[model samples]
Target chain A: MHASDDGPHGHHHEHDHSELSDTALRVRALESVLVEKGYVEPDALDAIIETYETRIGPRNGARVVAKAWADPAFRDGLRRDATAAIASLGFGGRQGEHMVAVENTPEEHNLVVCTLCSCYPWPVLGLPPVWYKSAAYRSRAVIDPRGVLADFGVTLPEGTRLRVWDSTAEIRYLVLPMRPAGTEGWSEEALADLVTRDSMIGTGLARAPGGVAA
Target chain B: MKPLNAMTAALEPVAPLPRCAEEPVFREPWEASAFAMTVALHQRGLFTWSEWAECLGEAIRAAQAEGDPDLGDTYYRHWLLALETMVARKGVAGAALLAQRQAAWDRAAHATPHGQPILLENDPLFTRGA
Candidate 1:
């Protein structure tokens, strides 16, 4: 969760444009090479960006978070059988046949780390951040969840249970962040305001009043 | 080297095309919820490995009759959809809870000048009607 823990690779943005690695240089070079070869087209780049921003992202999660905040019975259903529960709300697809939601409580914390790869609930959370699927976070979280959380400014007290979910094969985990107080009469729009990408991934909790900065 | 994948490489021919399937459009929320629900159940040990397998197989068969089989990729896609579905079904946070968290993420993302931009990578088949 901590960017610093990403490695001592220096700030990614600090690298000089031309001093980039061979892979980076080659990628840039290929653009011109393709154009010279009559392979590059104008709309291709735009299409890539459009797909990621609109077709896949947190809008999916926004809907889920909204639903969770509105219907207590539905929330219970999700906690019980997420697949059936989700189907009840008229949502389903290829990777969504099996759904599960884990609760994060005051005495217990849930952090999801895919030890194998970035096997995230993308349909729900959208594409995982590049860092989450990186080996650095994967290797470190399971061995040192507290240390990792500390980097994210989330140091839990002693005796608190920290459950590290290693997405081994068939299972993946999503954190059901605790609902912050002071919003008893909030609407779904208001509730959706509190759901953060990080909270969904279990790195941080949603703040009620002095909410964390985006 | 072999010409780069049209999608990943620069020289290949990569353009979108429609599917031949005949079902309604596939919404990811349901899939995400299903993925989450499966993961949650497995995590809680509510069902055994065999039982879960059977449930998935049944779901797959039903989906297949509708149109696509969604083999191979469903293993992980189901998990993503399941999570979304679960969130929708459970109402885990209630209205205020959802809003509060959404703002928190937004704030955290914006707090840092170098935050990673959110991106969406839609499944090709999902773009097609069921």
Candidate 2:
């Protein structure tokens, strides 16, 4: 596991008064203005904001992963239609929308990056983590995916076919890396240990490193 | 990664704007992802543009009666669900391969802390807002 600066359950500390910067406050204010103009309903807009900020996030994706690793049939369904497949796992929500999960193998590699704007699977994958939506990463991933992967310590062979997916549409693409080797007789929860966020983005592969899913 | 400080932070909320007149209750911001997805599929020749438009309109109406006026706001997910329902209803891509891929992504997300970050530059919300 990545080292937590605060340690496990480190969320108890309240050191930074500035942490509650309310960066979204300005956006909410603007939304209220639009609401007054009758462009959007106050309740609905509030729902959107609260859904993103509080109710949903990346942790949801983790749950889906844990479940899929446990069930064979459900895993098959997710591969067919990620959106509904995920819903079958009981993980769908408002923002997850239409889903397409792509796979990466030893012969072929797949990567997802949004070039135009950040269009992500919110319900299943939850809100996007930070780097997937960065300008530097977006431009560079398309132009030099190999180079960026190198930066991430993921080096692919020249023979490996690199498929870069620009997630610009309503249908979101999630990378499904080949199950790591040396994981026989492992439970789905243990198998889930091997899947990484980068693997889903097509940068890294799921490996059962150190008996932990790293 | 550590959360950004005020000076270096990248995600800041922008002021909201009024909805456009007759903006089609189906044209919610989240729905923009669905619109974009259909456009992508059309570009790839997965289906004709007219077919997508027709289907989207129909889905909007169906979801409306379901008491989901905000259905459009969550378009992409709806598109996924709709696509699943439609694909099953009509049989498009093979289900096994798709499920496998979805499982793979789930594993990947579980392994990586913070998973993938949705950069604002690539986010439809930011671009459409602009």
Candidate 3:
């Protein structure tokens, strides 16, 4: 995906140094300095990484979407105030302090992008995917949402209006994808299984029933 | 899932959006380290997210000015740069100290043998209590 894959940092250089990339080495150095200087605790850093790496991610968002699909009151709450609705589910902190949920219906679809930088909802969706942070997607999504969706193999009907949400550091967005057909009476757990990360990002649709083992 | 359509392939020649991966938020260990360090520092009240975002935005903008391409690979590099700037600006650490540490790491990395973890003590100039 790199125009010039000179190295990991995209700068050409010869280094007899050990296996770490330049940026990696720099981060390690800074981390050691911070830890030594008592600016940050090593264990705290580990805990933060562990949280994002494992504890938090799209599954949290899936549960939110599944609940919205199953519970009308919760959906109403999400519509009125997404931040409180999401936090009510015990998902709020860091990058997701402010939350907004835009629903997808037969007439309209919602997509999220950060034109300035990768301002994603960490509490819900965890860190953004590489594609979501790319300048190509950032610029293109706003200019041509349908084309970008097509790149992800998502095609809406001819008259379906597409709305793109440009996320910022202040507010992060989560697309409440339309519930798939044949999901009637399904448990929230099963419904959540159909909510993929891409679906929440509005690049793809939630999986149809039977797409995953219930 | 369907394959990438022809339209995006034709339009984006220089930098096309990468296909999304299902799992693993970070592509590298250092990325996770840098990301976690920022959050950890914020949790410690080093700086607010607004301050952090401003620094990151400036870093990204500066990188763009210097032709970063913004293809997503060097994103955490910018993140690390912003973290460094924020730490330095917040008086947590100065640029000189950070530079000193970086040089020490360079020496340590070069001195250490292959397949060995690079440690600050590995620096050839290392002196205890100095």
Cα lDDT computed for each candidate against the true fold: 0.52, 0.53, 0.85
> What order do candidates take by TM-score, descending?
3, 2, 1
- What is the per-residue lDDT of model 2 for residues A1-214, given as tens digits with 9 covering 90 to 100? 2433575875644322111112122222223233334444545544555555566554556556655656667767778878887777666644356778776657899888876545666675555544554445556678878766655556776798998887744667777777766666777667666666667777666766575333
Between 1 and 2, whose lDDT is larger?
2
lDDT of 3 by residue, A43-158 (tens): 88888888888899999999999999999999999988999999999999888878899999999999999888788998999888888877788888998888888777788988
TM-scores for every candidate against the unseen true structure:
0.48, 0.50, 0.88
What are the RMSD figures for all models against the true structure? 21.9, 20.0, 6.8
lDDT of 1 at A143: 73
Quote model 1's TM-score: 0.48
Instruction: At residue A177, give the lDDT of candidate 1.
Output: 77
Those runs of model 3 whose alpha carbons end farther than 4 Å from true positions after fitting are: A1-20, A212-214, B1-8, B12-15
Measure candidate 2: CA RMSD: 20.0
Q: Report residue B47 deviation for candidate 1 (angstroms).
A: 26
Strongest candidate by TM-score = 3
Model 3: number of clashes? 0
- On a 0 to 100 scale, what is the lDDT of residue A199 in model 1? 76
Chain A TM-score for each of the predictions: 0.71, 0.73, 0.88
User: Which number leads on DockQ?
Assistant: 3
